[model samples]
Target: MTPLSHIRNFSIVAHIDHGKSTLADRLIQSTNTVAERDMKEQLLDSMDIERERGITIKANTVRIDYTAKDGQAYVLNLIDTPGHVDFAYEVSRSMRAVEGSLLVVDSTQGVEAQTLANVYQAIDADHEIVPVFNKIDLPASDIDRVAEQVEDVIGIDASGAIAVSAKTGEGIVETLEAIVTELPAPKGDPDAPLKAMLVDSWYDPYLGVVVLVRIMDGVLRKGDQIKMMQTGARYGVDRIGVFRPQMQNIDALGPGEIGFITASIKQVRDTRVGDTITHEKKGTDTPLPGFKPAQPVVFCGLFPVDSAEFEDLRDAIDKLALNDASFSFEMETSAALGFGFRCGFLGLLHLEVIRDRIEREYDIELITTAPSVIYHVYLKDGTQMDLHNPADMPDPSTVDHIEEPRIKATILVPDEYLGDVLKLCQDRRGIQLDLTYAGSRAMVVYDLPLNEVVFDFYDRLKSVTKGYASFDYQLEGYREDNLVKMSVLVNEEPVDALSMMVHRDRAEMRGRAMCEKLKELIPRHMFKIPIQAAIGGKVIARETLSALRKDVTAKCYGGDATRKKKLLEKQKAGKKKMRQFGKVDIPQEAFISALKMDG
Candidate 1:
């Protein structure tokens, strides 16, 4: 077993596209952790979707052995975490498992909104952070300016910051040397009773559930009976291993070591993230303070395009849930869309990735409803309930008022695009909290409704700023708002899938946009269809989809005018009768398009 003083645990954190993964790859390659022949870009990102999207969806870990200038060998356990706001939960979880963080900043781009958010998380975790400036090979790289911004914005001293180009492998040796000298070693007592923190777990088809753990107090070995303190379940360890970036079996994991263990667990839930693992008989008396469970912020419904694939979708979701603990779902049905599941996600990106995975991995086409945030609905009788779907809203007469979830958003943009960014926020009913200058870029903070931002706010922000703006936000709790559910009707029949909640002041405008979009999307039938958007019983917006017409006079060549007139009259009568009994068949494509309102 390795001594505790020889082990150093740290995580690499930065903004999206700021080279966190590249830096990790360089470190792994420099230490010869993986053979050079097997080297690949983003080696830590094991999923295809992650590589295609150029994002890290899950935090991945690896262990490397490096001999420093002191001529002493050391063990470094590195956790590479996602940089996007949607995966902030993954970053925080990784933070708790390490004692220090390597803050990577893009020298070409001084500072971003996500950079501040992640750096603060490290600070909150009481991590010893070492600043590293990346992309120094680029002509636009400005190391001094970024260091100043880091000091001014994040309040971290950057005087001794290391500058490197992760793309070209510069400054990698210095980076490893700094990790050994600057960062403190993890402290743990190998003789103490077993106390390990379950940092993450996922389902492995061949091996069942594999858990990644950080040994805090004692030794964990193969074939030993262990207990999860939080869930109070016992199991015998089947295998013990460590990631050389490739799984290598090991005999035992001592204190301050990070490794993987298989306990013949049937499900991932049986080994919850952040749970304390201890020996079944002589375990520690006090359990570690595990983090709170992840709370899904956005909600939506996902249904298979082919109703026959509902069972397939269920199987896919079950398999996905075994790997992703943050994603949640429940069975739900819609009048127009048929059977589906109501799913919850951390953010819009999380929802899209899951939908895409189900479609691609499971080979099932899907239709997704409008994404919404949870609401607090209070009744006149002093009772409150949580509202996940607008279609399931309670009667307005019984409800006293509705409180909508709001968010505190931070946006960093160049000075030239600041006006457009502010206007976009104002149009979304945002209240400006503060605005300041960080060098040439403007940082603006706003208190905005979460539902408004959920739709097309991010897209609008990117378009208006020409993709130069970086944004991040967190839930700011709920506030009372004059919100009401807007229902869309086709041929005077309500479509529950398109129903959504909007503020009373902007309901009419939003309703008009929904009606106009639906009119263009829904195909014309034999009868005229009246499309309306209504709040309760009052219609706020209306659009008429004209019926498909046929030439009735074609069959009456050289006949009396009265014959043509009679034919037209008969056709009008038939249309009227058909309108009353007609069942509108909304094609699957239309349902998907209508929900993607570009306005």
Candidate 2:
């Protein structure tokens, strides 16, 4: 067995686009963790959607053998964590598996809100932090200023700050040395009862459900009968595997070892993250640290472009849920959307990542409603269900009272946009809680309804402020408020898919902006469509665009019968590309393109 003294465990934490994955790739390559020819960029992010989006959605661990400057062989267990705020809960869970963290900060962008949040999380987890300022080779990078900021914010000594450009392989060796020196070896009871925490798990078609666990105490081996602490279910372990970035099947795993275990457990719910695994015979009271399953912060309805793919969508979601525990779905059918699921997610990016993966990996096409947040409403009998769409909401008369989800939002923006941001927040029913100054930027906190800010608020803020603002939020639960159910109309027909309940204060302005975007996004079909925003059955705003009457006129045949057949065929093909929403058939790109609207 490999001794725990030679092991070093750490994770890379950083903001998005701050070279976290890039540094991980270089580390993996330099230490020969993977072969040179087989080394793919951002190799730790093995999922297709992760690579396409250039983000780490899941925390992955890989072990590498590196020879230190003192000529000692070291076993480095490197964990690559998600950079976005959506996966903060997952980040905290993985932090328990490591003794140290490499806080990767971008020299050009300095410290973002996410960076600060993650640094605090690592510190709170009692992990040693090695600050690394990345992107030093960029022309705009100011390493010295960022170093000072890191020192000031993290309260760490500045002498060990390693500046590197992961893109150019600069200062990588020093970073490696720092890992060996700063990170401590795992300290735990290796001969105690078997105890481990399931950090991540996924279903493999060839091997069944495989769980990735970090052993905290005692030893685990193949053919041992183990019990899940939470479920009390038993399984005889088939094989224990370790990751060298790729799953490496092994005979056993010991304390401080991070690896995978495959049992005959076929059901998805049996293998839960944070569930403790223990030897059934020993029955030691030493249980693994458990973390609460992630609570979803966003919800939306998803359907296919064609109704025939409903089952396909369900299969895709089922397969995705094997790896992503944050995505929750309930069987639902929309009057306009047909059979689909009301899916819940941790945040906006989590929703998008699931959607992208389902489409890309499963090769299924889908159409999704605008993302919504959960709302608490009391019924006549006092029963409550969190409503994701206004259509599902009980009538105001039936609702004895209503409360909307509120979030504690922290935003950091340049001083120039403070006035505009304040106005925008006020329009969204945001009440300022506190404010502070960080250099030229103002750190403003607001308590706002979740429904108000979910629609185009982030995009508008970024646009109005020239992308200089950083926003982070946490759920503060529900609060009593006066809200109105608003429905969107196309040609005087109510669209159940686009309805939402929002604060009454800013409905008019937001309605107008939303209708304008809808007008631009909803395609011109066989007939003209009128986009209208209505509150309580009263039209508040309206917009319209002319129909595409001449779309098929050019293809019409004048005299030849064969030409007429060809024209009809071309028209049918064109119609196949359009998505039918009531009387209007919209193009496939309209839904996505509309999301990028500046307004």
Candidate 3:
């Protein structure tokens, strides 16, 4: 067994597309964990979606055996974490499992919004942060400028920061040496009761649920009875292993070691992330601290394009949810959408990832409604309720006040595009808090409603800044707002899934735009259809879909004017009857298109 003092647990934290996965590959290769012939690009990222998007959605852990120049062998566990703000919870979980972090920044891009956000997280976790400037091999790399930016933005000492080109394997050995000497060693008692933290888990068809855990104290062995402190679920460990780039079975894992524990667990829900695991008979007096379930912030309705495939969609969601604990779904029915699931996600990217996985992995087409953020409804009766869907909102009169979730957003962009970006934020009801400059880049902070940014804010930000702005945000609690729920009506009938909560001042304008967009999407029917947007009993905006024309007059080409008039009257009568009794067959695409509004 490796001595506790010889083990160093650390993770790599950075912004998206900052070569985090590449750096991880360099570290693995430099240690000779995998043979050169067997090594592949982004070997730590196992998911096809991750590789295709060039982003890490999941946190991956690997143990490396390295022989330092001090003539001592060290067990180095590297937990590679996602860089996107959507997976901030995963980063926090990984931080809890490690003692230090390698804060990576691109030499050309300097410190971005996500990089600052993650550095703050590492600081909050009390982890030792080692600043690393990456991609120095690039032509635009200014190592000194980036090091100064890191110090100015992150308030860290960059004099000792390592500069390395992960792509060329330069300065990799020095990085490893820094990890051994600079980072603190993990400290835990081997004789104490078994206490481990489940940072992540996944469902394995062959081995059941594989739980990735960091052993804090005592030892965990195969066949030992383990119980989850949060759920109180008990199971005998079926296997114990560590990731040497891949799963390698081990007899036991002790304190300071990061490994997997399989206990024939059938469901991923049972093996909760951020939960504590302890020996059934030798459990600790209290479970580990800082355990909380992930809460989804963005929500949308997902329906199979063909209603007949609802069951297939349900099964697919369950299977996917087994691996993604941050994703949540429940059964929901809509007048326009028939039957579907109301799914919740961490953020927009998380929502997109889940949607893509359902379509690609399950081979099922889906119709996703507009995404919304959870709102808090306060009633005059001194009661509070959480509103996940706009359709579930109570009458405006009954609501004394409504509070919407807001976020403290930080954006980093080139100084030249600062005005345009600031204008975009202000248009979205964002209140500018501060603006500072880090060299040629400007860091802008704002307090904006979460719902405002959930849809097309990022895309628009990219457009305005010419893809140079980087954004990061965190929940800043809910605040009271002049909010009202706007409903869409087709032929005088309301569609629940199309309802949206908007500021009262912009409700009429938004409603008008929604109706206009819907008119373009809904196909012409035999009867005239009037699409109206209303709040409560008052209609604010309306659009009409003209009835399809027929060749009723063509048949009477040789007849007199009286015959033509008779045919026209009959056609009008038929259309009237159809309007009274016939239901508007709004196509699935119409609903999706109507709610696809970015502004």
* Best candidate (score: lDDT): 1
Better of 1 and 2 by lDDT: 1
TM of each candidate vs. truth:
0.98, 0.88, 0.96
Compared with the true structure, what per-residue lDDT tens digits does model 2 show for residues 395-423? 67787778888999888888999998888
lDDT of 1: 0.94
Candidate 3 residue 398 Cα shift, in angstroms, is 2.4
lDDT of 1 by residue, 1-599 (tens): 88878889999999999999999999999999999999999999998899999999999999999999999999999999999999999999899999999999999987899999999999999999999999999999998899999999999999989999999999999999999999999998989999999999999999999999999999999999999998999999999999999889999999989999998999987888889999999899998889988899999999988999999999999999999999999999998888999999999999989988999999999999999999999999999999999999999999999999999999999999999999889988899999999988999999999998988889989999999999999988999999999999999999999999999999999899989988888889999999999999999999999999988778788858999999999999999999999988888777777776565
Candidate 1: segments with Cα more than 4 A from true spot: none
Candidate ranking under TM-score, highest first, comes to 1, 3, 2
Comparison by TM-score, 2 against 3, better one: 3
What are the per-model C-alpha RMSD values against the true structure?
A: 1.1, 6.4, 1.7
Cα lDDT for residue 378, model 2? 82
